[model samples]
Target chain A: MFKLLISLALLLWVNTSFAISLIVNDSVSFSPDSSKDIRNIFTLQQTHWENGNKIQVFVFPDDNDVHQQFSKSVTQMFPYQYRRIWDRVTFSGTGLAPTIVNSMEEMLEKVSQTKNSIGYIENIDKHQSIRVIILQGDENEAQ
Target chain B: MKHNKRYFHASLLQKGLLSLLLALWIQPAFAIELADNIQVHGFLTQGAFYTSDNNYNGDSDDDVSFDQTEIGLNAFWQVNDRVDFSVQGLYRKAGKVENGDVRLDYGMMNVNLFNDENNHFGLRLGRIKNPIGLYNETRDVAFTTPSILLPQSIYLERSRSLLVASDGGQLFSKHQLGDGWLSIKLNYGNTHNDNDEIRDQMFVSYAHGDLDSEDGSFVGQIKYNYQSDKYIFALSYADVTLEYDSSSRDLIPFADGTARFSPYIFSAQYNGEKLSLTTEYYYSENEFKDFGAYSPDLSPITTNWYVQGEYRLSHKWQAIMRYDESYLDKDDRSGKNYEAMGAPGHMGFTKDSMIGVRWDIRPDVMLRAEYHNINGTSWLPNADNPDRKETKRYWDLFSLQMSYRF
Candidate 1:
């Protein structure tokens, strides 16, 4: 009985450590009108204002690891890769890089205040002004 | 005037009221959501240049001048999941000319033929950079290379004569191979000069036999890039030939006097958190059919090499140094005899070294200052004295430039 209890405790620790949760505000809808692909959510330029009236975006700083991971998942590129792509685009006058914010709190605040702004966070439960977009599970039920 | 003032005041008041209402309406009618499509961005830069010696020859002593000031605009519109249209435009001053001539540098349309996880293929038409070396491909206003002065060996001043900036079309594709990438580009087309006199001269006098015709020579380039998180290396090869009208002009023929050039280059760069180093070297050979009747056989090979290093002192400042040298065949230098009588066998050598600093005042703006010491073993027409022979000359060059991008 003691062995079984210890094994259960270890399983719980592993599960909690590797838990992958995509945090969003509580009010965001997963329906088509308010829904978007991960690519669209990460790369979009403008968002609805936090007062829920207009559009704009909240961006990750250039050196942020979360931004790097987000870009990697969406564009399949690293920070430098995106930088080179953006550099070529900007230099040629074809597109611009995104605006950056410093911290997750800043990102959350901006996204909450400006409806058009969107950013990712590790902890979604603390923010009351936004809604989380439900992400479907993978074949392995990883999410 | 009073009536106009009243009208203007009324209009201003109306604008304020409309803006307030629009803000209010926008606040609630729209969910504070970001647009999933459409983007706006640009960059700007300004800088100055100074030459220690009056390098301008007979030109004015204003050793300092605006090095670069440019603005760019970019728009990317997603038509659908698989298709998007991208366009870019730029306005900047000429780099080599004495007068600060502002011109549209690039306006191109891009269509992503294919964009996959590990590979991408695209078609670009309009003004595009001739991708020769690492810097030439990204020499836009927003991308500042570590070197204050560009590598002159491969980035020749004469490249403009051979390559097109916006003219013609190019097909390019990149394939990702694990930690490396391979890119292939094929380009064809002709650039028509606005100046009739210059165009005619380039075709009839400057070009080799039958090269100046409507069918300009074809150019092809292959580049392989390998990058890990900290280090990067690139290898590239390019060949170009221009045809001239030999039958129409008074031509002096030597053996195999066709103007043909093949350049092979290798470059490597390493970047640490606070330091970066880059090195590049190129070897090129040019062949002439008949050495202006002076020699039945004359060929010259030019070798150029440079290494540069940079260290970041703080968040906003950096220091850099570079050494560059060009070695020409000392036997085939150009002169009145070489030009008029056509001596196919006169060549000279030149070497230059430079150091500089860069201050990033902001993300879109930077200030740069550099100094160069140049030494040469031959005499150029623009030198202090053309009649002097076997001379070594020295000069000091100073320049300051500011660059910004949006």
Candidate 2:
């Protein structure tokens, strides 16, 4: 019983995390209205931007803290679900998986340099070149 | 000439896949980065199986079997905005069927005709995996599935090679529905019919001949995802035709005959944060006709289904439970007709209850183990069990697999 209680407490603690920003390349013109579009972009269902630039998806690894925050709080999905989608699409040769970066620094760098790319980070600095996409849903605000 | 040409191509594919497997050994998964906009990925899986009272994937009855192994290397190149090309080579071993053979899994050139955030259209030409169920295309890759063994009632190993992939073209389209997306795919091509397991399935013990399906086959699916990860639904359909030719020297050889299969699948799933529920139903119509003096004309309507639940213990561990069932003739649930026709009654159906656990030891590695308590022997592959009468009605199977992917 004590072990079960500890596991439950840990689950709740992990479920609660700090917010993360949905960083995108500044060249994208249209903004996503709801969390569905954001989820579609990460899952590779939405491939191209309004301006015709192909969507280059980037992400942290499944075990990353920022990734856990972005997945649970923002997209309302688990990280393993994203991994499942990516692996299924990749191995079947139907689509592409997201590029994995090491840390927030790498995430900021990749999203800033790549064209029409999208990723997330815990915090953005003042001079970073990437644009922050604010979701309109009732979830959580940007960190 | 055509037969020889096909043999030549198979050998070429074997050599290519083998050399690539050797080349990728030195450079591990994480260190090797090919180029920008061009990526290469690969995976390897090894499994050992132990079964009581029946043979599976080897002589596994009361013995440990190591016949299940798969290695694959795939490369993808995105050429500009509208087109991309991808190819994969595979080396797989599963008992005497698919015995350490190399195969060209899929090589496709995809062209995007039109695309936006809400709508997209595309075409893929070359060898491509058939979009049968949600898991058929990525079935061999252990990282993509729920357990070491997929539900046998729906994804039967006995006739797997026939439905693995096709050499032809496919058209795919996606459209935004109410807060979700609906995708449609249509494929028309020729599937391989050279597998001995399939031949064993189509004929009786002493009826030695060959099975061919040079004619074309058709497969299509319509799938809908609601809220991206909340609810999913799909419907898949396929029609295949196989022909048999008798060899002169064979004893008890029958004349040329034809067999046809038309199957429909209904699939649904619910994905929550900690738990996932999946269920699928399969209904098929089989027809066998025009074999002089073999048996009688037969048509069996088959049904199969499975329901499963998975729970995540943490990010790195998960558990699964499933109940699967299959019937060759729904009217004869006890297989009484088969028993009347000189085969075991249990040969016409199978019911399996399974439990499994998975551990993700690292980001690129996974290990899974499963145990199944099964009743009946309808889905056992013939290559592993040459005589149907030797199989026991009640059996058990345990398997463990380790996989590496990047």
Candidate 3:
């Protein structure tokens, strides 16, 4: 009985550590106006503010662990596949790939300042400037 | 024409300054977080090729020797989560055309129809690459097969009937099937031009692949093509009839021979981290009918296949070797033949065995030097005069090509 309790505790700890949360600035709103259902605040396609406006996007840089998790949860596509798809899109004159931002603070600041932007950041503290868009998994369970 | 020239000059100057400024700006920005929402990137490739037999024939004396150069540029821009666009341009010079001629290889808009958590679908329409073979699909500068030289059997030089662009649409869908994944692509469109004397020829091909991992994969494709990739493969069973004016009627031995033809191909490819191989077999048969009694029946069968291997010596250099052979059966004369001495010649065989080295000057550019020993029997008729034949025994051919992508 004691061994079972210890093992259950360890599994819970592992699951929590691996669990990822996506966050966005509160200013952005869910839009039926755009082709998709949701949008985030970002700038320059990265998480930077361009003239005090935030941009929006789908993925992050190569080294960010949170970015990797977010990508897996949201698109189920790896960084390589995402990049290839973006490359094809860009070369075909379709649209641009999303920009990358560093740190949650930068993502928050950029998103708060930008309009019609979208992005994903780690959820920790709730803020007035951003809102957490609930994501559902393949099982339709909210992540 | 004058206004177009002026616009071209002005754009050239503007692009030069913009590129310089972009390079400077991007260098400092690299340290920070990448911008979000939208990103702009592109690549350019320029290359030169020198061939021993410029005429593409075994006869060296007819020597139409020249240097060939080509430049390709590709750009991509994403609008939002579900929409994107890309444009590619190519400039090529083969013989003494003086100024290089430019053509748009791919300019298309892609719309993501379904972008769910696990699945995505996209549709593209414009001047797109004809995805007939494994290598032909990725003919763009950024994506290339392992070898420096694509298999000539499919991507033949000067064969616009094959490897050319198509004004069409393609639909692609991907779904995660349990542990592995599957992708399906369907393409439908018309040929760019009626170069083969056949008008409004339609092409349809299907490709499917399963991803085992990042480093290895298998893909298969089937296509019905009317154009010749390199040297004509005679295994096609489609009907090809030539449209003849009264003046040219005497030149043709058969008055009722149709000029329509069709070809069927089955191809497969496997790619590993260090090694890749692709092999294909094609069959085409031309039938001539409604000709006079003197018309002879000619049936030809052609078989073509090539195997290539590559070893990455380092990040910047690689070595490759390829062996290619094609055989045609000329003795089968079920179709109409237009000669008094029965069929003009027996079905012949051609072989090109080559070994080459490629230097990756950069990710978007490469330089290759190759040597090929070519041996062949029989000859194909020239476009101008069908009665004349050009055949050769064996020759040593040396070639050098530089390819780049911007």
Candidate 4:
């Protein structure tokens, strides 16, 4: 009984480690829209923001664990589906692919420094460089 | 002899493409990092095929052939919020038909006239890939296609150059439609006017000449994606007319004529977590008129379709099965009437069943193998097998390919 309890606690701890949060530059000045809208932006269907600023998207590579987690939990999609969508648009010359960063540190740095930039990281660290863009359902609770 | 001259001319275009490709391939190596918004990507693939009977992608009868390969490089730059530029160059060798030709696949400048939270309106001008079915735009990319060779029923490999891309302008809009997203595109341009393979295969013994695409060639497609991008449905249409300029030594001496080809396609797909199902149907009304000799006025409505299912067994392994068919005349499924029209019975239609596996060895590298059991020789490329009598009614083919993209 004691072993089962400890194993369950360890599993929860591992699950928490896989959590991801959406982040954007401080200049974005926009709240996360509906899930559909967020998906469109990431899929390159929506090229610009409401304020006429070109949306610059950054992301970790497809094989990254954090990237997969963010795609499922936040975008509500699998990595292959997301990659297929990007490949269709990119290879067809209909749209551009998002910039790929090598590491989470690079993703954080690029998203924070670039204007109108958006990305996700494994954790939401308190820093002046980045601001967490809470999702639609979590916005009120976060505030 | 006329076909030889045309091939020579086409090879010249290929040469120019090759030089430009080289420039692009080496430019980035020496150039400084332009900006964070500038991105360059490319892919390379080499394929080998073997056939029990008949020939495809080269003379693959009872022997393996490595006459299929593709190389492409593209770059994109976001100049600003409303404007972006993109260009891709391709070098492909598909047996005697394509022959290592380098071509400009697409070079377009997109201007986002209006963009908001839910609406996007854009205009693009240059050589653009025609949005026929789901796979037409990125058909050459091995990673993007379900198989190394796409379904020939709808995506005909012969006469591919004419249908792939055009030089013109396009206007597009993407907006929210109820619970799904709707995308509409309209384009008008001059077709890529390569008539060698078309004349060789489509005309056969009936006629021979150079085909020149006249004005007023256009294409359009409308697509809707359901919530979360699970289900997608699209309809596309294209109308292209080519003028036949006859040579003196033609099989049937005749005056100049016009060949008008128009095809309508319906496409749908359901994408799930580990399983994906897709299908597309095509109907084409093609007419040839005014060739004053023994050539009779011919108007044939060809129909074709394919059903494919893919299951991802693991992160690195995937399995696929598909059934594809194409009929030269829907009314004559057995081709008895077509055969009576001086064409071989096997030319009337083709049915193919295929199974394949793909293993992604790495994020950028992939290896794949597939087997095909084909009935009828309707889609046999004329360039590879110039003599029709040599083609068999039933054949089997196995293919292996490796591709890498960065």
Candidate 5:
């Protein structure tokens, strides 16, 4: 009976702990701004930071679980939809696609080390190289 | 037998060249990183098509036809934060419609007049893709297209050359308005036209004439994206003018004339977690005068629309369905007046129903299969199927394609 209760608690903890949010290089010092503003950056529609520095975007592959979760929870979009947008603009010579990393660790390493870089992670850890920017609305809004 | 040998040799050369280009494209992406902001990308697509009755591209009526292939290589050099240069080279062979020749797709310089986090204004000079509709800019890229073929009602492949790109300039602006984003693009230029194919499709018979583009033609589109970019609405308009200079051919008894085509399209799309829906409605007016043999008193206005839905079945699979309709004359949907004029009634409209599935074989490779049930042959160009009078009213088509990108 005790083992069953402990297992159930562990599953709940795992489910609730996957809190996804935006993570940017330490150079950014913005608050919960408009979701539309962030969408433009991630989509490569917007390229410059307010300070006139080119914004580099890092992301995981389309099928990555955390990537999908971040897109849905933060941007309220499907992974394929986001990918299609990138393909349209990139192949058309109208815009560029974000740099894709193979894993979340690479995403963190790239986003943290590169200047003006932005990315997302689940349960982001507190680090001097990166800062977590809370999204404007409730993360559960995507549901 | 000589013609067959030439065709075989041409296909062999195409294969060898594409294989070499593919090898170059497969080089390490990190090598492109040597140049700070230079990015190179390319795509290769090959399709096999079979039809139940009528032909679609090549001899696809009863037997499988391998007449469609698209290859492209594009590069972008961000010279500076405020300026960039882009170029793309493309080779496409779609039956007689595209003659499998390498050509420059788009080569332009983009200068950002003003750019910040919230607002952007830019000017593009030289050859640029016509920003007419959502799919026109990247129509040749199979990865960017929703299906093996785009909805032909709005993006008719018959006159693709005239609508694809222009040698002129464009001005574009994007701004964040309250909770939404607004983007506007305007282009002015002269576009290239395939004279023989254009004449064949426009006039009943091939007119021995040269098609010339009138200067000052323009295209514009305004797009509003809201709801965190999940919803998009766009309005596009274009005015295309062509003048036919008749050649001295007794068999082609045609006089010099001018043709004007203007079209307006409204598009909307909604993206959801498991489903995405898209719809577009367009109205077009085409006017031709002083053709000697064929002339219309007034412009004929046509209407077309398509409703498409896609459902993501899993991480690697998707299902799609779309219904597309077009009428040559909105007021005469039955096409009786067209039939009375000695042309087949079905020539005035087209209705197509398509169902398809897509699988992402890998991140860089994709496989697609689709079936289409079509009524009417309005969109079929005479170049592909010369016997228009014998075209059946109802037909079915099936196609499969494999596409790779890097």
Candidate 6:
């Protein structure tokens, strides 16, 4: 019975953990030079592309499952931390916040349609123009 | 103009209640998005306070009083790629001290001068929020703070107007360093006028004259955030000056003086997924010169510090504990210098220990309750406790607040 319980707990943990990929629009040809660039972009530290086209970020809401995993796995930050950063910037009139979508499908759609936009999705859906950018480092060593 | 203030206060409280209902019914529409890329955001926070001995926010001597309220609305308009316009209107009532009034919180046009892959820089002109410590800029917003009352050792409530915002220019820059980001912000501006409360605190209501900041103040800060805020360290400095012009009809002898204050702060934080640790230290040198014939020039170096820890119990619940300390003069930690002049010895400093819990009912709504065990009257507003002698050396304060934002 103990072995069965342990196996069930492991299964539950595995079912909850999922891989998230960073997606960019078709107009973007270059990816982040380093892992820090990914964080800088999403955290509003980096606002423009190297070519000067402004980056319009789209993402799921803070409570969304995929968004939570993406923040911890892909961006290597907690959802609450991102929320705090966004709220501080927004209220203090320091910077702008990303457009929050409702679902992963909506995220995929927005990134594909918007120019120079970036977001994360659990898996690549039916999208011809949106490209998935492979992050450089492991999530554990991101800091 | 006599009954006008009471009428206005009543309306503001009504507005606060009205918006609270509106938030509950229409949660999504709280954030209004315009067609031309303009986004509107705001927050409403209502608090109830009860103190075991002293007064806070209202007549809270053993009675729950709902006198602290903050209502604000801000708009961000992306005018173009290089410039954005931001404006906000605030109505705050923080006790008998800060009566209800509609004031412009901040109105600025941030012009993006330059940006590239790894660096971004900007110049913000107009009325801007002063970047003090981590929570000064967004102090009034309840959703952004961990507890109802922030560490009063540094973010003092009496000097709210002087430290809140400035009407001048600010330059901000962010650079991506090796495995981290470095941000620097510098501000130079004249403080807005509202010195009656501050003057009363300093002179015990003796100066019935105008007290204002004639010279512009300067504030600058540099911060390095590592690993997307797993670790953070910051250094902030400010030089502020004020002048008090005494009137002939005052109660006490005429005392005209200039006060120069320079405060240096070092802040550090470690943010983990479930727990966070933060500590900040303040070293301030204050000089008071030329305050009449009898009063000698006095310069005191004040010291204050606080250490806090926050643990996330779950996705929507959080608990925080903090120990904050402050001294009017580091040399007179025991308040003997002031006791020599016939005053409560405990009034020279304050040591506060607080514990709080927060429940995020929804993404836009929050409920929080906190208790503070305080050992002095240093940071208490003079308006709340007019007779400082009646205050208890060891007192307890309890507060509850509900906040909604989008």
The top-ranked prediction according to TM-score is 6
Candidate 5 lDDT by residue in tens digits, B229-284: 57889999999888988877524566788888899999999878788899999999
> Which residue window of length 10 is worst by lDDT in model 4 chain B?
B1-10
Worst 10 residues of 5 chain B by lDDT: B1-10
Q: Model 4 over residues B1-406: C-alpha lDDT tens digits?
A: 0121211122354355445545544442211225877777887777888888877887678776777878888888888888889999999989888878789999999999998877888899999899999899999999899998899998888768888988999999999777678999899999887777777665674556788897958999999988646899999999999888888778767678888889999999998889999999999999989867555688989999999999999878999999999998788788775466566688889999999999987667778999999999888888888777667889899999877677
Sorted by DockQ (best first), the order is 2, 6, 4, 5, 1, 3
Give the least accurate 10-residue stretch of model 4 chain A, judged by summed lDDT: A1-10
Reference-based TM-score of each model: 0.63, 0.88, 0.56, 0.88, 0.87, 0.90
lDDT of 3 by residue, B272-340 (tens): 334445566555554534445544444455455677666657646778788876654445232122123
| lDDT (10s digit) by residue, model 4, range A33-60 | 4456667778877778779999888878
Pairs of residues clashing in candidate 5: none
- Candidate 1 lDDT over A23-82, as tens digits, reads 333334322122123333333211222233222335565556666545453333455444
- Pick the winner on TM-score between candidates 3 and 4: 4
RMSD (CA, Å), each prediction:
13.0, 9.3, 13.7, 8.1, 7.8, 8.2
Local distance difference test scores for all models:
0.47, 0.78, 0.42, 0.78, 0.76, 0.79
* Two-chain complex of model 2, DockQ on C-alpha atoms against the true structure: 0.49
> How well does chain B match by TM-score in each candidate?
0.69, 0.91, 0.65, 0.90, 0.91, 0.94
Q: Higher DockQ: candidate 3 or 6?
A: 6
Model 6 misplaced stretches (Cα beyond 4 Å): A1-17, A125-143, B1-19, B22-26, B340-342
When summed lDDT is taken over every stretch of 10 residues in candidate 5 chain A, the lowest stretch is: A1-10
Residues B269-380, model 1: lDDT tens digits: 7666567788888877756454345343445676777888888786568888888876654344332233343222122444678888888664445678887777652222
Positional deviation of residue B33's Cα in model 5 after best superposition, in angstroms: 3.8
Candidate 2 chain B has its poorest 10 consecutive residues by lDDT at B1-10
Superpose all Cα atoms of candidate 6 onto the true structure and report the RMSD in Å to 1 decimal: 8.2
Task: For residue B37, give model 5's deviation from the true position in Å.
Answer: 1.0
**Between candidates 1 and 5, the lDDT winner:** 5
Docking class of 4: acceptable
Q: List candidate 3 stretches off by more than 4 Å.
A: A1-143, B1-54, B57-66, B95-100, B140-143, B178-181, B194-250, B253-262, B284-301, B328-348, B377-391
